[model samples]
Target: MRSNRDRAILALAVSTAARASELLGLRGADLDWGDQLAQVRRKGSGAQQWLPASAESFVWLRLYLEDLGPLGPDAPVWWTLRRRERSGDVLERRPLTYDALRAVLRRANTALGTNWTMHDLRHTSALRMVRSQRLSLRDVQVVLGHAHLTTTQIYLVEDDQEILRRVHQYLADQAEPSQEAVASESTVGYDSNDLAVLLGGVPR
Candidate 1:
């Protein structure tokens, strides 16, 4: 994505797994740089919480904001790059709206030849967290703000393709002998009598 704003938005979405509305509602003051946490407004409850984000996301966010020049802490975090017509028949910098965000994704989907939506980003984030195994399901549940742990357990379901890959890898591993074992085995020639004894026959 050439648009730094879109890049920042995408980075934050996958890293934080925050709802689109939560991300859109972020103000310039919402970030805690020291902890690398972001304050996002949770959907439904309208409550706000801190979300841990990737450092790369912060890099993109800083770049996007730097391009916009200085903004007050209370200024909306996301803004339209192109000046838009506002009330009083004047063109002014406007906060990035949901429609504009959709347009951004539409353009990206067109260029990438993929049909994806903002909600997909949240799914992607959750899957990544679950598969990484660095975070527990409970942690993921908290991050996703699920009312019950069972909601996060949905990710525990194995994907068909992933199961296939793991099975193939295991079969391949089983088919091979450990090099250490092979190296430790005796390679000396055995006499015929010794071979017969080993084969459960009388030594002859």
Candidate 2:
């Protein structure tokens, strides 16, 4: 986890949820560098867009690239290198495969002792948009890259917690008596028998 470059790439992937291909396609020029918002073109997308970076992510990405010198616009943003393994084995400098991404995720998850799948990050993002930020389905649709609004709507939920919170708040807000109602009730006070009749109940 202390390997700065790998960690930075992991955080970037988790935060953005962009396809691995799209992410690998990124270049130094694609990033604002100062603001850290990255402009990404999806692999099959006709549109290009910006992704805001977390401050921590921005910091690490800069740190990782600082000594690498100038990376050309078309160069792989996440380049692989033949580095000695923990056991002193050397590997090839090929572009990282999708399998490598999954392996990294698995190792990270094990170290953290969490059951997180690579795709789960996307679901987590959608859930956060709905629950934490209260973003609209349309906003989520664009964010999650869902072509259809209905597909995005699947992330919005009327789950038990949301339902219960709404019900409790509504009841609490209604519980306080209005001054006019209280005064009217006082003026119309009646005997116990009258009260019982008005309530449609016989006296106990």
Find the candidate with the highest TM-score and give its number: 1
The lDDT values for all models are 0.88, 0.71
lDDT of 2 by residue, 58-158 (tens): 77787778745567776666655656667457765556666776777778889999877657766665677777556676776776676778887787766
Give the 10-residue window scoring lowest on summed lDDT in candidate 1: 81-90
Which stretches of candidate 1 lie above 4 Å from their native place? 81-90, 177-204
Error of 2 at 201 (Å): 45
Candidate 1 lDDT by residue in tens digits, 1-204: 767888999999999999899999998789888888889889999888999999989989889888989978888889985644465555578899999999989998999999888899999999989887588888999999898998898878678999899999999988997787687675557788988988999887
Clash count for each candidate, listed in order shown: 0, 0
TM-score, one value per model: 0.80, 0.68
Q: Point out the worst 10-residue segment of candidate 2 by lDDT.
A: 79-88
TM accuracy, model 1: 0.80
Task: Using lDDT, give the best candidate's number.
Answer: 1
Model 2: runs farther than 4 Å from truth? 67-69, 83-93, 132-134, 158-204
Clashing pairs in 1: none
